[model samples]
Structures are given as C-alpha cells and as structure tokens.
Target chain A: MRLKCPLCGDRDAREFHYRGAAKLMERPEAGAGEAAFYDYVYLRENPVGANSELWFHELGCRAWLCVSRDVSSHEILSVELADAVKRGQA
Target chain B: MVDLTGLSALEGLLPYEVDGAVLSAVSYGAITSIMPFRGQKTAVNVRLKADGGAALPRIGRVSGPVAKRLIWAGRGQYLLLDLRRGAAFDTTPDPAFDELAALSDQTSAWVVMRLEGARAQEVLARLCPLDLRAGVFKRGHVARTELAHMAVILWRRPKGFEIMVVRSVAQVAMRRLSGAMDSVAAQAVLGEIS
Candidate 1:
C-alpha cells in the first residue's frame, strides 16, 4: 500500500513501520490498579476503519507519520508527519 | 576510551558507568528493506522497487586494468554490485506476497535502533542467535538475523553494530539487552551508540 507522508511525500508502506493507534498506552497512572494495568499492558484493540494511527519510517528518513486509511478499500484518506504535536492533532 | 551505558553496573569497577546503548525513543522509520552495494572506494545503498516496478538505478562500473577485466555484456544495462560484500536483492516475485513480506520485513510498522558501546557484543549475545564475536564478524558485514526471538537485520559498522528489530519487541528486548550490558562494561569502550 502507498501512504502519502506529509513531510516525506508519498512512499510505499515498505518505507515505514506501523506502531498501532497513536495513543494506546497511559504510563501506568502512578501506581494503577492491577486490572487497569493489565488491560493497558496486555490487551490490544484491533479496529478496522479510518483511524489515526502511528507509524515510523524504519527504512527511509526515519520520520513519524499519521495515516488515515481503509482496511477494505485500500484507500488512503490522509497522511502527515508526526507533526500532530505541532499542529495539535493530538 | 569513553565509558558508555551499562559499563559501571557490571563489575562496579568500571572507570565510569556506561548504559550500553539505551533506546532513545527515536524512530528508525517503518520496516524498510536495505540494499547494500559497493565498488572500488565507494558503497551505495538503494531501496529496490519490490512491487514489480522495475526501477534500476545506474551507477558507474568498477575500474580495473582496462585491457583485462572488461568483461562486456555490451548493449545490456548493467547493475553494479560490490563483489567485496554480499548483496541483498528483492527475492519476492509474487505481488500478493509482497504486501505480506513487507510487513514481515517490517515494511509496515517498526523502528530500527543502532546499539553499540563497550558492552555492545555482550548485550547482543544475550538475545541474538548470531555470534557477535569480532573474530567471526569483522567490520562491513550485514545479515538478516534474529534478535529477542524476532527476525532482524543487523549491519556491522566500524564503531560498533546496528540492529533493527520489531517495535513490539522493544521493551522486552531493552530489558534483556540492558541487563546483558550491565553484565559487561568492565574494560572496552563498547564504542559509540546512536
């Protein structure tokens, strides 16, 4: 699949590594409960749709990217750098 | 001469404490295939067009005694390979398999970190199936090896070595690697870790 990286331009998926949804973990809330901690560390949520997920370029320039795509249609909605912190997409 | 991460923790007699090479939280990009090629004094890395799109990047050929070593294919396009080193090529000829191979190759979501220090070899030995001894591995070598029980591609550089494993294996690998380096760090510099 092809992803348009906002900073690196359109690149094949081979250029990046998927890290899952942007924010999936909360740094164990200063001594959280056992169940809550287990959920955060052990469980994973796999969703299919247009979701904002995190990615890294392990092969290319090594940049952070945000991508919105469909699992079925193989269509990409949008892609940009890890600039979500600067643009406030976070 | 400089101590690095994990140095002081081992024997506790280390000049200065070194941490081996800690994961800096930097991104090495997603799973990407690396192509290593070389000529006489130069080496080039090119990422192949693995999706059945043939993009052959042309580089000048090696220079030798023109009267002898000029074996010619004449009109055909030449792809340069540094015979001094082993070259990696895209072996996947299947389109459907390319997408999945990309993921296995970490073409989707992954990070690559370069780990080296006085404790480099010790750290790698703990989790890698490959031997990290200098006698077996000199400089300018690369391999698709395994780390922390995951398939990885490791390239040996001058200073130390660089390893790329899956992101999901990060925390676990780090714990094991750090502990391993902490086991060493007594004498050598472990080299520079980036």
Candidate 2:
C-alpha cells in the first residue's frame, strides 16, 4: 500500500504508522457524570466500511494525516494533512 | 579550552573518492532550525527574505543565496545553512522576526555530506527509495526519507546532492553511502566486461 503525502507525494506505506480513528472526541466538561467519561474513553464505533483514520508519516514529512479509507477493501479515498483538516483549510 | 579540531563526525572518512562519486563532509558557518509561530508563515517569510535574500522554501524544495541555503525540513520547519564561514551559532536574534518565529542552533546535532559526480544519482538510488530520476527529483528539490533505516534529509544541487543526518548515526550513514557507491561502481564495471 502507498499513501500520497501532500508534501512528499506518494510513498510506501512502511514510511507511515497507522494511528486510530480520526474523529475528534469530545471530552466531558468538569462535573460531568462518570458514565459520560467512560463512554468517551472506551466506546468506539467499529465501522467496517468507509472510515476516517489518522496516520503518522513518521519517515517522510513527519506530518499527521487524516486518511479516508475503506476498512474492508483497504482502498484509500483521500489523504489530507491533519493540521489543515483541523484548521478547516483542507 | 578543549582541543576540538578533530572531533567532527566525519573526521576520518571524508574526502572519499570512488568510481563515479566523491563523498566529502561539508563545513558550515551555522545551521539553524527555524519554526514559524502559529499563523505567522507570511511574517516569517518576510523576515527570512530580509535576512537570507530569499523567502522560506516551500515543502519539498530548497531556496536561498549561494552562500546560504534554506532547506524545507518538514511541516512548519526549515534548516538554514550558512556555508561561507565555519563559525558556530552566532546569529543575533532579529527583533523583527522574534514574534514570528523561533530559531534553534542545530550545528552540532547534524552531520552533512555532499555526494557529487556523473554517477552520483545511481549510487543514491541504490539506498534511497525515492524516485530520483533527473526530471522527478531535479535541482532545488528536497525530501525527507529513510536511508539504511536512518532518517535523513536530502536536497538536490546543481552538481550533485547533499545529505544531512543526525550526528549519532553519522558513521552508519557514511558506511551505507560508501557501500552503495561501491555496489554501483561494481555494477558498471561488470556491464563493461560483459
């Protein structure tokens, strides 16, 4: 598998590390119930189809990437710099 | 003061010449890492242009005066090298850029080497996985990749290429680069024989 880095272009997958889901998790506010905190920490939706994930280009640009991919088919739909995505510029 | 003249990482292995390339250590006046503050990319570029005669290089590129080169070193970072003198870090903080960026001396942290010759690209191809064809990786292009399992920064020059690696792995890098050079040289000789 290969990932097209926005800065470095397409590179082998060995240069990147697979981080987990890319969805932003909301932390419970102070005094929020334990159940809410527990769910935030432990619960994750196991989507088998298209999923947004985070990856670290450890050996390439050293940028965090948000990768939209198909979990079952391993098809990468898109890759964007995580910082740009968070800033709404991607 | 301690005698530090012979303490360079490539003290003994440099000035190595092989069949198609020459490997030599690069002496720089200063090497600094510049990281722009949040939302200060334009400010940082202006400051760098005033100081180095060029703006900060874009990703996968290098730019600057002949004496000083600014190499893109990953997201929000650049490695500025002054090659005219061999002094240590001596740049006074520019107040104009103080709020726009941060500068850190990286002179002793990295060891730089230059590989140049007609067949230098072939030697590099033996170790690095990047597509280094002349058209693909032309002069002024930069890439951060692994060479022999060690992280390295590579930039193309008009005559050849420059490689920068952390000081801790300088010996290993040199060995691997020399090995690749030897391998390519042998292949060229075999091709002629057959």
Candidate 3:
C-alpha cells in the first residue's frame, strides 16, 4: 500500500506508521470526570466501513496526517495535515 | 583541551570520484535550522524576506540568496546553508527577529555531501525511493526520506544533487552511497559487454 503525504508526496506504507483513529486527538477537557477520562484513554470503536485515522510519516516528511479511508477496501479518500485539522484549518 | 581541528565524520574518505558521479563532502560556512514560533509564521516570513531577500520555501522546495540557500526541512522548519562562510557563520538568532523564530546550529549535527556528474541520477536511483525524473523532482526540490534505512534529506541542484544525513550515521550513509555507485557502474559495464 502507498500513502500520499501532503508534504512528501506519494510514499510507500513502510515509510509511515499507522497511529490509529484520528478521534484520539480529541482529548477530554481537564477535570471533566472519571468516565470521560476513562473513555478518552481506553475506548475505541472498530468501525467496519469508512473511518478517519491518524498516521505518522516516520521515514518521509515526519508529519502527522489525518487520513479518511475505507476499512474494507483499504481505499484512502483524503489525507490532510493533522496539525491543520487540529487548528480547524483543514 | 583536546586538539580537534581536523576531525570529520567521513574521516577523509570523501571527494570520491566514480564512473558516473563524484561524491564530495560539502564545507559550509554555517548551517542553521529555523523554526517559526507558533502562530508567528507570517512574522517569520517577513523577517526572513527582509534578511535573505526571499520568503520561506514551500514544502519540497528551496529558496534564499545564491550563496545562502534555505531548504524546507519539514513542517514549519528550514535549513539555512551558507556556503561562503564555511564553519564560521554565526548561528545565534538575529536580535531583530528573535521573538519571531527559533534558530539552532546544525552544522555539526549533519554531514553534507554532494553528488554530481552526467550519470548522477542513475547512481541516486539505485538507493533513493523518490521519483527523481527531471520533470518530477526538478531542480531546487527537496525530499526527506530514508536511504538504506538511514534518514536523509535529498535536494536536487542544477547540475546534480546534495544529501544530508545525521552525523551519527554518516559512515553508514557513505558506505551505502558508495555501494550504490558501484552497483550502477557495474550495470553500465555489463550493458556495454552485452
């Protein structure tokens, strides 16, 4: 498989590290409660179809990316910089 | 104090000339990494333009004055290469824009090398995974990737290319580059015989 890095262009999957769901970036607010913190720390959903994920271009541009991909077919619909996504600019 | 004047990462095994390319260590006056402070990119760009007469380069690009090249290292980062001042360039942040950006010396952190020749592309193709065709990776293009498991920055120059790798792994990079050159040379010889 190949992942197209926004900065480095298309690169082999070997150059990237799959960092799991992009939802992980949304941490709960400080002092939000134990349940919220627990969910944030350990809960994950195994979605069957389309999913948003976080990936690190460890050997390429070294940038974190948010990739919208299909779980069943492994087709990537879009890729954006994780930082931009965090800043609401993507 | 220890006498450490003539030390180099390659230990004198540089300026190697092969059938298709010449590998030589680059002696730069100064090398620094510049990173714009959070939300200060615009200010940093203005400062860089005032200082170097050019804006920060986009990803996979390079800019700056002729002798002092600014290469985009990654997100929000650039590597400034001042060739004319080899090892003597000041690395401290210019007081005029110290609040806009962060500057760090990288001269000793990296080992710079240049590969140039008519067949330089062929030699590089053996080790690099990037698409380096003239139309694709044009002059002034930069790429941060791995060559033989060693992280490296590849910059396409007008005549050939420049490669920078961390000093800790410079020996491995040198060996791998030499091996790639030899492999390409061997292929050429076999093609002629066939």
The candidate scoring highest on DockQ is 2
Kindly list the per-residue Cα lDDT of model 2 for residues B151-191, writing each as its tens digit.
89998877789999999999999999998888888888889
* Ranking, lDDT, top scorer first: 2, 3, 1
Task: Tell me the deviation in Å of residue B52 in model 1.
Answer: 18
**Pairs of residues clashing in candidate 2:** none
Off by over 4 Å in 2: A24-33, B1-6, B86-95, B192-194
Q: Per-residue lDDT for A1-90 in model 3, tens only? A: 888888888897778889898888898889899999899888888888889999998887789999999999999889999998999942
Task: State what share of the real interface contacts each candidate retains.
Answer: 0.00, 0.69, 0.69
Q: Candidate 2 chain B, which ten residues in sequence have the lowest lDDT sum?
A: B85-94
On residues B30-69, what C-alpha lDDT tens digit does candidate 3 reach at each position?
6888888998989988887777557889888999765788
| DockQ score for model 3 | 0.74
Local distance difference test, each candidate: 0.47, 0.85, 0.84
**lDDT score, candidate 3, position B178:** 87
Clash counts for the predictions, in order = 28, 0, 4
Model 1, position B159: C-alpha lDDT score: 52
TM-score of chain B of each: 0.45, 0.91, 0.90
For candidate 3, the lDDT comes to 0.84
Q: Rank the candidates by DockQ, best first.
A: 2, 3, 1
Judged by DockQ cut-offs, the docking class of candidate 1 is: incorrect
